[model samples]
Target: MIKSLLIANRGEIACRIIRTARAMGVRTVAVYADADAKALHVRMADDAVHIGQSPAAESYLVGERIIAAAKQTGAEAIHPGYGFLSENAAFAQAVIDAGLVWVGPKPASINAMGLKDAAKALMAEAGVPVTPGYMGEDQSDERLKAEADAIGYPVLIKAVAGGGGKGMRKVDAEGDFLSSLESCRREARASFGNDVVLIEKFILSPRHIEVQVFGDSQGNVVHLFERDCSLQRRHQKVIEEAPAPGMNEATREAICAAAVKAAQAVNYEGAGTIEFIADASEGLRADRTWFMEMNTRLQVEHPVTEEITGVDLVEWQLRVASGEPIPLRQEELSIDGHAMEVRLYAEDPASGFLPSTGRLDRLAFGDATRIETGVEEGGQVSPFYDPMIAKVVCHGEDREAAIDALIDSLADTEVWPVRTNAGFLVRALDAEDFRKADLDTSFIERHGDDLIPSGEADDAIWSVAAQIAAGDDQDELVGFRLNAPARHAVWLSHRGEGRLIDLAEAEAIAFEDDGDLLSAVDTTATAYADGDRVVVFSDGVGYAFDTAVRGSGQGSAADGAIFAPMPGKVIAVDVAEGDSVAEGQRLLVLEAMKMEHAMTAPFAGTVKSLTVAAGQQVEVESLLVEIEPDEG
Candidate 1:
């Protein structure tokens, strides 16, 4: 076995690898950027090394730096946890060339499946079922348009080297093809350094199903069943489950077999996943499923597969990298029960699910579920990396029971100040369609209204905030004077509404009071105050209210100034100082947490000032531009 290993990643996945390594009596080395010096993974590892600056391109993506760190720290192997340089074929070769064991598949395998266009042709030639589309090498825009026309309308323009929905676009008609292709290429270049693309027929009701396969140096490969990742938002997976809810024996066997065949065809080794896009319009038919792509490393949602199969996939990766054969034979592995995993992110569901960054303040989840996290209460959710807070996994005897457990777990979770998708996950799991196994890529969109919580905080919630502000004292009538009831009014702003409530000194705030005329508030609320800002937890959602004080907590920016919504680096400034802009025209693009957010003009105007330049790092609410309203 490899005596020591270095994890070339960050967050939960890095910590996960360290845990299994420790259990196996293998020393682990952790690498961190400047922003992650105090991160949980850094503290958990046996030894640590500083790589470079915070940005991944400057740090984690530097293959030579990682390899040198591993060698200097005496690590015998390097584990590139799922992102960054994990799927980079060159990085794998670098590790091997440096005499360090690469804790992933061979570089040849990664190169084989590196690009979607090339991989499709290879899979087809190897007898794997592939979707009908254009994977030609023509790089001309006119050729792409012709291919889309040939494939018919409603085709997908996808980055040839893309994952996690970064460089993918869906076009419903011919008129939208060029712009969509441009957007796809731009994102692809930004993400993968590749501008190549592929067009495919879009499956209207597609169910994303993937099989977890493992291979060893001994040429043994086996499948650990399948996972259903149908629930998605913004083309990214939101929830995943093992032993797909409505999967029958025949479909399961066929999909798993095809996955094994794909892996064997590549002569793959280590942990990998074969993702299939299943057309579920008529339910899961083996023939309707098409090969989408292969993930050359461990998946973010590997815990669900681990839960049902009673296996530790990370340990398998380590063992295989250390030259062990497949842990279990094909007959030995079978689905045991149902397991579901939901990705909990530090992002606001109300504000277009923008990444929420700040102090954790409060992060808690139930003990009944498995929680994989790398952050603590005082940890910061930086804009330099992914905004994921944790992964909550629950298992039960069956699908319904597993979902019930998952819902309960989500309801029990509490994250304050930094917003989260907890409430949304609960509502999604409780949706009738979800409970009935009616799932597809459009699940979230179909039930979006129910999932997005109302922004307005109710009277009861306001009362709870008031009580917390009043020190939670039930002995004295709040704000009451001896002569008369003291007129103490608390001003709060929530969801664009300013609420003013008067507190009577003679009446105590009761926790059990119903929302009647006198007690129109539910008092069983959790609240904490940060100076004048109070955050209350109610109905599985966190509501933050700013105390309406003069010169504080007002609307963002001046009348003509465009302020940064969150702390990020200005990647592109689209307007000049004297440029005229129309309403809703994008003025700049801010790159935060590896995602791009466009800042647009509120109304037609002329640029009065451009405060920040491209590549400048700004804080939340920092002014980026100032506009003067056009004189009519």
Candidate 2:
């Protein structure tokens, strides 16, 4: 087996690869950004190297820096843990030329699937079923639209270089095709540095099923079953499970065999995933599947595959990289049970899934199956990286039990500082359609609200908030007197409304006025006192309300003004001198953390004032737009 390895990635994935390297008696090296200096992966690695600045372009994407780190650390092999340089063909070649084993597929394999347009062409020639559409390089808008029209309306306008849903759009009508195409191209250029795009037939209701395949130097390849990644929002996968629901034995075998053939076609080695979009609208079968793309390294949802097979895939990677024969033959491998994974992100689902950042005051999730995270209690959820805090994976004897276990585990998690999808996940598990496996890529969009919990914090818990707001008793800690019932007015905010609750009773208290039900619209609020510290849960997050009651006052109209949703540079301004605008009009675009977010007007008004310009960095909640009443 390989004696040592260098993981050219950061966060949970780097840590994950290092774990497998350690288990296999292989030394590990970690390359990090300045922001990841305190990351768990660095702390756990046998040795560490600082690659470059925090930004990916300056650091992780710097193939030279990564290769140098591996050479200096004496690591014989480099493992590109998904994202960053994992699928970069040049990077793979660089590692090999540096006299280090690239613990992944060959550079040829990476190039074969680097561009979606090219990959689709290769798949078609290899007898793999592919979605019918235009993969031509002719970027002429007229030519592209012509292709879309011929392929039929409702085709997908996707950037050939797209990932993370950045540069992809669905056009249901010819009139909307050009604008959506422009948006996709612009986003693709900004996000991936390539404006190349392709049009594909848009499946009305498709389930994303990908087969994980492994190959070694000995010309052997085997498939590790399939994972259903249909549960997604905005083209980003949120939940994934193995052994797709309602998949018959014959269908599963055919898909797995096709995945193996695809891998062998590229002479692929190490861990790779072949994603296929299936027409699950009619139910999963052998005939209704088409090629999507391939991820040529360890995937984010690898845990579920691990749980069912009871095999350490990382160990297999290292062994295969060392030129060992394939670990287990195709017939010898069989999945034991069911496994599911939920990606927990530190983003506000209510506000268009905007990224949230701050100190992680507390993060306590129960130990059900496995929850992989890099943040500690005092750590920070920086906008410098992915807002995802962790991935929770659960395993059980069957799918139903696995899902039930996932629900229980998500409920046990307690995250602070940023809004999360915890409540939404809980609601999703109880949903009828989800229970029946009636899912697709558009499942979240079709039933988004069903997954978002209606403010349902325990009523008993709210009774306490009402009491505290009503000042039933004075705090014995700060304002306490043995004489009169200590009545006090405290300001509090939850969901979208703020209020003052005044109470005088010592033991029991209630809201002073239940005029406007704050809890009804806002998130359910939870309040608890453990000795002197107070813990509160709202908006799918648990927080320490230290001085929450003391600083419970509303800000001026300035506070009501629109603020930057994230820490990004302004890209465009929609308003000029005294322009009238309607509610939800895009006022400006802020580019931060590699994604562009538009700040919109909260209500119909005239542009009273605007601040900042394109290419200026603004912190979260920094005012970006101001509006006034439109008397005209």
**Maximum-lDDT candidate:** 1
Compared with the true structure, what per-residue lDDT tens digits does model 2 show for residues 337-424? 9999999888766556667776665676755699888777778777777778899899999999998898878766767545577778
**Clashing residue pair totals per candidate (backbone < 3 A):** 3, 14
TM-score of 1: 0.83
After TM-score superposition, what is the CA distance of residue 52 in candidate 2 from its true location, in Å?
Answer: 1.9
Q: What is the TM-score of each candidate against the true structure?
A: 0.83, 0.81
Every model: Cα RMSD to truth: 6.1, 6.7
**Full-model lDDT, candidate 1:** 0.84
lDDT of each: 0.84, 0.78
Give residue 224's error in model 1 in angstroms: 0.6
Misplaced by over 4 Å in model 1 are 141-143, 476-525, 545-632
* Model 1, span 330-369: residue lDDT tens: 8998888899999998877767787878677678675445
